[model samples]
Target: MKDTQIKKLIEAEKKRQKKAINLIASENYVSRDVLEALGSELTNKYAEGYAGKRYYGGNDIIDKIEELCIDRALKLFRLDPNEWHVNVQPLSGSPANLAVFTALVPRGGVKQEDGTTSVAGKIMGMSLDQGGHLTHGQKVSATGKFWQQIPYGLDPVTETINYDQLREIAMKEKPTIVVSGYTAYPRIIDWKKMREVSDASEGLMMVDMSHIAGLVAGGVYPSPFDYADVVTTTTHKTLRGPRAALIFVKKDARELYKKIDKAVFPGLQGGPHANQIAAVAVALKEASTPAFRKYANQVVKNAKVLAEELEKRGWRLISGGTDSHLILVDTWNDGKKREPLVKDAAGKAEAGAGAITGKEASERLEKQGIIVNKNAIPFDKRPPADPSGIRLGTAAETTRGRKEKDFKLIAKKMDEILRK
Candidate 1:
């Protein structure tokens, strides 16, 4: 109430959110309870270590609070504490993933004859332009600098992951790990196959389900717990919590559990943000309710409707359609129905040299009070800054109480903007 400067900016952001049709797949709106917890007095605490083990004093209440969050996370996901060690201290997804890889693969490298060195170990993962996150091994990220990255892409024709090729590459590359979950690809990943590939290559498997944490909790999408050696996810996306993340280590690998805990505490972060953790607990509790399950299912329903409506409008959908809450559309040109085996002749004349480019479509849509992000479709010729596609998700809209009909209308709005 005192500092109107910050308060006014906050109010302005609130207004913008209220007025916009948010279709960003990686975003969602949290409830009032979650927001309250995020701004509670718990933020004043200085709990550095896990529950019951604090580096500073005055943590009696903090211990119980963190334990409650850990307990709720396990219960919400139906995980047995004996089999999985849950660490709720990660600041976010990217850091959490870095801790995992840093624990498994240290930063030391092999010295060459030239006195130079190369990062040891190889991480097999999806490529960024093909819908993979930067942490998965894009050169720009530290993950790539720390270790070698073996990038895997989708089939040019199908625009979907080919398990056979993945297995072959894993077997030959023999990477240190295999990452299963993705950022933008709108299809269900085969966790079992990924596990098999990891096993054959004598490597570990990790799944970043940050984008669909709520769906996994609601039992709508496939759970990676049964297959992955470790699972990392953010609480803020479909989970509808504050900005926080969780790391789940399989109990079968007790050593890995210990390694991950150490990496998170000493290797990466210092004292955890108790307020965010408290909000995560509240969100986890809310996600376990029956109402959340309905919301999760509806998210998928709305996405399917979006894809269907867009297809009816002659928009080309990458990989045909979506099985989750996200859809990727190639707006470079009239995707309609023709098989695009190459990247040329895609984005139209308006694009000049590039497709509508994700940036153009995004800006045009934003002008109409609709929000979305430009993305790269499979075999996209344009660069990452402006890819050949635009990504749409129904999580935020579905959370706003919009249903299938509303999503269909949203799809039409998208079509109209792209046309302009």
Candidate 2:
């Protein structure tokens, strides 16, 4: 605490968080125990490898801490240790995903005599504009640079995943892997259909359940373990843990666990963050309790209530409503029963009026102590910096003990701010 300047900034941030209405879907507040573990003396240690197999000496304690975290992660989701292998390293979600793809998916482009190369395989994932994460093969990410992405998106009419169309694309594109879970998506994914698509295409299936990991552990959302070959999730987000990630590999004849472990350690990172691992262990244990289950269910309920209230107040909701903690509200267009915009061939907007842009709405909300991110709607014409929608989530406020009525008021406040 000798660094007065840094301490003052940290205190300022604390006050800001306390005063603001946080609706960021991928964010959550951790407990004191988790914070204590994060700042523990374990950060001084350097354990350059997995538990009991470290390259450095005097790591017995670090080994125990990591192993406990791995065990708790499996136990929280009711996974059999024998059937699943957990990698507790991989700094965060993005790297965790990269490690998985690097381990399994082939980076095509062998040199060709004609000075052109063919893509040996593709990653079939939901399009980023349609609620998928960038790690799922967006053009700007490293994953896309190394491998091609075959993007699928929501149906124009229903604003939800068209499974039949997804199957048709998978069958034709023949992707190396089909990723099911998403970042901004609010509906429950049909894991069975994704599995069938993967099967028909003879590809692997991976689920990035980072957004809903806690809900799955609480038995409120469906677990992807039964369908996915591998599952990657962040310990933060709905998990309410430290900023860490876990990669779960299903034990099969393919020996994916070995590949994933190697990819995480020597493949992607050096010594794992022992302190962060310990904190994740605490959160996993905390998430296993009955109280966390109630919290998780309440998160979904609060989201539904907020979405309903917003729609009733004339805000446009993508996909009609949400089945999870996240809600996507179209802020650029007029309210429910609004007319559609005219578009050019490139899908750029040609005409619209009498509505607020996502960026303007977000800025207005923040001035009123509300926090939310401007996001892209499905088939959005606007750029990523200021799209047509703003995403909201209930986990953080719900953790602060807010309930249905609180969220209803939040919706009312948001509606008033945006409409102005």
Candidate 3:
């Protein structure tokens, strides 16, 4: 490493990771083998097309690497190669999702003065404020720009999904596709109910299982494959892989695989990152082992212990509890006397009692070597940047060999910090 500055920063990050109690739900630590693959010589090559159908000449080895990745991905998830097709070339989760929409959804077009047609589609997904990802067609994202989002939310009192309301919305909107998986959602999704909704609306079902892919692989969480027509997931997150994504399309009369493949290659990106693909292959193999299964189960257990401890400590948990590795806690005023901003005699806004915001809670936790993200809870009145809640996860800490006892202690520490 001749670049001394970059090397120093990398070393500093390593030290930081070693000391910090990582709770970021979207993050995880990869193995040394995955790291080696990421920095391998395969990065020097440019394979602009799929395996064996490449535009470049020196891609025979690249083809084999990619084929192995696709094979392991299928095998890890117990999917038959003949029944399911996977595209491992999309740079990350966002582009992978975009490729799916471009391939399957119908884009209604408007004629322009320059004799061109501008097109947009419709996507039905959970509302961002209620635990949806931005790629699920939130207004600020490009997914929203090129497509209109028909949003759904959780039940106000229970703070969990209401299948009846979701079906009604889907039936009314008749969106081109309905997305099931989410970012901040903590419970196991009812894929069968989602399937019914998609069926009633005559729309495609795509589940972005990016957050829970590893749990699904370990058989700890329900697999959405039985219901969803297509599934998109990032290899990172709970998958414990590289920062890559895979799009799996069910083979049927629709021929969705071909459309999505074209969208990923010529329709979206050029040469695939052969190195990242190889790393993902290693991860898929690793995830198939019995040891990884234990790790996945422990992840959920650790999250439960953490959530229960937090609740007992007087913190309000969204949905009351969790069935997955994620938990949302109302760290602010808990929707009670939330008037954190009030006018003084001079008509100037001032901070009031019990006014700790999510942002402040996150900062306080970070100061104590715990890392978490501020998030918006269901029916939250506070803004997204500094919402009324904080999201915590146990995957990374559990990966570091933390258990129920460790999480209990971590929860107690967290309660102490935030209460201050």
Q: Please, what are the lDDT tens digits per residue for candidate 1 over residues 222-323?
A: 999989899999888888888989999998734798899999998899999999998999999999999999999999999999999887666778988999
Question: What TM-score does structure 3 among the candidates reach?
Answer: 0.94
> What ranges in model 1 sit over 4 Å off?
110-119, 334-355
lDDT string for model 3 (1-420, tens) is: 999999999999999999999999999999999999999999999999999899999889999999999999999999999899999998999999989988887665878779988656679998899999999999888788879999999999888889999899988889889998999989989999999989878999999999999999988999998989999999999999999999999999889999999999899999999999999999999999999999999999999999988776667789988999999987775546434334578976544334468899999999999999999988888988989888888889888999999999998898778766
- When 1 and 2 are scored with TM-score, the better candidate is 2
TM-score to native of every candidate shown: 0.93, 0.94, 0.94
Ranked candidates, highest lDDT first:
2, 3, 1
272 in model 2: Cα distance from truth in Å? 0.4
Q: Residue 122 CA error for candidate 2 (Å)?
A: 1.3
Tens-place lDDT per residue, model 2, 229-333, is 999999999999999999999998999999999999899899899999999999999999999999999999999999998876666789999999999988876
lDDT of all predictions: 0.87, 0.90, 0.90
Q: Lowest-scoring 10 consecutive residues by lDDT in candidate 2?
A: 334-343
